[model samples]
Target: MMRFFTGLITVTLLLGGVGTVWLFLTPSGTNLRYLMADTLITTQHRSWAKYIIGQHAMETRVQAYQQQFNEMGEERDTHEIHPDSVPAQAPAAGTNHEAETALTEKKPLVEIEEISGHGYSGYVMTVNDPTKIRIGVPEKKGRGERVLSMAERTGAIAGVNGGGFADPNWQGNGFQPIGIVMSGGELFYDDLGKSKSTQVVGLDDNGKMVAGRYSLDELKALGVKEAVTFQPRIIVNGKGLIKDAADGWGIAPRTAMGQREDGAILFVVIDGRQPGHSIGANLYDVQQIMLEHGAVIAANLDGGSSTVLVKDGQVLNKPSTKSSEGRYLPSAFLVFEHPELAEIQNVWAGLKPGDIDPGKW
Candidate 1:
C-alpha cells in the first residue's frame, strides 16, 4: 500500500511539471503573463510582482520577443494597413479647409465595421462629425450609471465607454473618475494639483478630436467641449507612439478614441478575457488599426470590463464582464443628432471627493 501511494504521488508530480511546461509554451500562456504583469503595475503603487520578475527585465524580454516577431514580416490573418498607404500629410491642427472638404466628400456619418488581426477580433465605429459627440454624466453625485442608461436618458444614437473610475478590489461603484471630467465646456471634476497636467481625450470647439497632456487652463483655452482623463497617448501626428506589443499595455479588452485625417472620430472596442473568441489586443494592434482607418491622432480610453459599445439603444459589442450590459461608469461618449440640444446635468456639483466612497457600492 505504501508503494502504491508513493507511485501515485510521483505520477502527480510529473504531471504537474508537464502541465507547467505546456502552459508556458502556449500563446495563451504568454499573453497571460503579460496581462498579469500589466495589471500588477497599473493597479498597485508598488507591486511585489514587479520585484519578483524584475520589471525592467520583463519589459525588455517582452519587447525583444515582439520585435523579433515583427521583423519576421509574415502576414497572417491581419487587417493592418501599411504605413505607406496612409496619406503623407494629415489634417492640420484645429479645423481647416481640408477638414471641411473631407467632411463634404462622400462618407457615412457613422460607420461600424468588423476589425480582425493576428490574434484578436473587434469592432470600430467611425463618426464623421465630432461636434455630435458629447459626454453623459450621471444625475446623482456619488453613484454610478450604466452606459445604456445614460444613452437612453440623453437620447443618444450611439454610446461608448469613456474615462477610468475608482474600483476598490475591482468591486467599486465606478462613481468616481480618476481625474477631471469636463462636459459641455464645464469642469465637472478636478483631483490633480493646481496647474498640473493630465492626458485628456476630447473634442475642441472646432469639432476636431484633441488628445494630449494638458492642464485645466490649457484645455479651456483650447475650447475643449468634452473631456475625460486617461493615459498613454498611442498615436500623435500620424506616428505610432508605442514601439511594439511589449510596450503596448498588455493585451486585454480595450477602448480607444481617435480621429482620422478627415476629422472623423473612431471608437474602437476589443473584447478579451474570453478564450476561443478573442484573447485580447495590445496597444500596438490598436495603433495599427487606427492608422489603417486613417486616424492621425489616437488615445486609449478606459478598457477592461468598462470597454463597451452601444448603438441605437442596443449594446453592440460583447463586453468582457459578467454583467451583460457592462460595469457602471462615470461617463460615456454619447452621439446624438443634435448634441447642442441634448441636456446633461452636472451631477457632481456641490460634492467633494471626501464625501464619496466607491467601495461602499
Candidate 2:
C-alpha cells in the first residue's frame, strides 16, 4: 500500500513541475508523514495534491538512501551531517589522495589504497614499512558525542555510548560498535590525565596537528601497563580505566602487556579463524605471530570484523567485509597533516582533556 501510493505521487509530482520545490522545502524524516496524511486529487493542479505527491517522491528517495545507508551501516544513525559533509569545505590541500601521497618516498602508506569513508581523512606521516604505521585520528567527532573518549580512541569492539552493548541514552535503538586496527608489535600505552606534554597531535580540517591533554607520563600509565598478543601482532598499552567495565571491547584487557624484539611495542588484535573471518587475527594466533615478530608485550584492539587499515585512499584490510555490522568504535588514530601541527596545537589550547564523548555501538 505504501509503495503503491508513493509511486503514484511521484509520477504526478514529476508531471506537475513542483518536484524541485517540494524536495527543497521538505525536510528529512517528514516525507513519510506527508505521504500517508493526504489523498490524491488528479484534477487539482497547483493544489495540495502537488504538495502531497512531491512529499511522496521525496519520501521514496529517502527510503532508497536509507537502504544505501544501511549498506554503509556506520552512517545509518548519523543522519544529520556536519558542515564538513559538504564539498564546500574541502580538507587541507595535502590531505587529499594526490597531495598527501605525492611524497611517495616519504609516505608509502598514503600512496597505497585509500579508504577515506569512515568520517575521517588521513596522511601517511612516515610509512617506513607496511609493518610500522603511525596513524593519526583527526578531530572530527560525531555530533551527539561530547568528545571522543579513550575507549573510542582505542578502537574498542563496543561503543562507549549506548549502542552495541546497549545504553539508556539511545534507548536500545542502535547497533553494536565493531572497530579495530592492525599492527605487528606492541605499542606503548599511558594515561593523559595529569601530564600535559604527551598530548594528542592530530588535525583540524585546515591541515594542522593539534595538541591534546595528558603528558607522556600520563599516557604511558593509562595506555599501556601490560601487553598481550594476537594475529598480525603488535603492542598496545593496557590500562584503560572503565569503572563499570563489562567487556574490554574485544580481547581481555590484561592481555595488552609485554615488549617486543625490535623494542617497538605496538598493539595487536587477533581473532578466531572462522568462516567469514578466516583471515582475522585472534588471541591464540596473535601469541604465535607476535612471538615471531619478537613481540614481548602485546594486546588486542577491536578485531574480528573490526580489523582495518587505510593505505593510500583505500581500506587496506577488510573492515567487516563479511559482516554488514561495521566495527563499532569510540575513537581512532587517523593520520593527517603533521605540517599543520602548530595549527592543531592552537585548537587544543582552547580545549580540555577528555572532551570527546564515547559512542554506543
Candidate 3:
C-alpha cells in the first residue's frame, strides 16, 4: 500500500514539473503569459500582473504600447467622405415593390448588425446620418453618466461610450476627462496647452470623420464639431495600422469608431471577460473589422468594462459590469433625430484637473 501511494505521488510531481517548464519556456506559453498581463493592466488589479510578468517588464511593455499609439497618431489621415451618396433608409424586408417605395421613404436612423470573429462577438452600429451624431454629457453637475442615461436624456436614437478618464484604482467618478472634449462645435474642455497636441476622435463640420493627432489650432481649423481625446487611430487612408493579432494591445472588450467612404459612422462594441459568450478582441482584430466594413478612417475608443451600446433608451449589448449597465463615462457619441436640439451642457466648464477629485463618488 505504501509503495502504491509513493508511486502515485512521484508521477504527479513529475507531471507538474513538466507542465511548469512548458508553460514558462514555450513561445506559445510566453505569448499567453504576456496576454494575461496585458489584460490585467486594463483592470483595477493591475499590480497582480507582476506575478505573470515582472513589474519592470510590465512597465516596459506599457511604455512601448504608449509610444506605438503615439506614433500611430502622428501619421496624417487624408481620407474624405461624402454623405450625399449614403442611402438614407434601410432596404425593405421582402418584395421589390416594397423596396422601391422604401428607398424614397426616410430610412431607419441607425442600423445594427451582429459581428463575430475568432474568439470575440459584438455589434456594429451604422449611423446613416453622420451629421446627427453628437457627444452627450452627464445631466447632473458632479458625476459621470451611463451611455443609456445620456441617450435617454437627449432623446437620442443610439449611443456608444467615448474617451478615457482619471479612474484612480478603477473606481473613478468619471467626471474628469483626460485631455479634451468638444461638443456642438464648441470647446467644452481643454487640458492640452496651446502648443501641445493629443490624439482625438470626432467629426468635422462636413460630417467627415476626423481622427489622429492634432493641436488645438488644427482641430479648430478643421472645424471639428464633436470631439473627444482617445488613442491609436487603427486605420487611416484605408490602411490597417496594427500588423497582427499578437501586436493587438491585448484581448479585452473594445470600442472603436470608423467612417465609411459614404460618410456613415460605424461604432464597434465588442464584449469581453465573459468566459463562454466572448473573450474579447485586440486592436488588430478591430482594425480588420473596420477595413472589412469599408472604413477609410478608424480610431480606438475607451473600452473594457466601459464598452456599451444603447438604442431607443435601452441598453442593446450586455455590458461587462457588475450592474450590467456599464461604467460612468464623461462622454458618449449619441445619434439624434435633430442633433442640433440636444442640450449637452459642459459639466467641466469651470473645473481644472487639480480641482476635480476622481475618487469622490
Winning model by lDDT = 3
lDDT tens digits by residue: candidate 3, 1-361: 9999999999999999998887799998899999889888877788988999899999999999999999999888888787666655666567597677867786577999999999899999998778999998888767899999899888898999999888988888898888889999998888776648999999998899999999988999999999999988999999999999889988889999999998889999999989899999999999999999999999999999899999887887778899678999899999999987888898878776677787898
Whole-model lDDT, candidate 3?
A: 0.89
Better of 1 and 2 by TM-score: 1
Per-residue lDDT for 24 in model 3? 91
Rank by TM-score, descending?
3, 1, 2
Please count the clashing residue pairs in each candidate, in the order shown: 0, 101, 1
Clashes of 2: 101
lDDT of 2 by residue, 10-74 (tens): 99978666655555466643453343222122111214444645656645644553343223211
Alpha carbon lDDT at 280, candidate 1: 81
Whose TM-score is greatest here?
3
Give a tens-digit lDDT track for model 1, residues 120-142.
Answer: 78899988777799999887767
Candidates in order have lDDT scores of 0.78, 0.29, 0.89
**Model 1 off-target regions past 4 Å?**
1-36, 39-106
Residue 180 local lDDT, model 1: 86
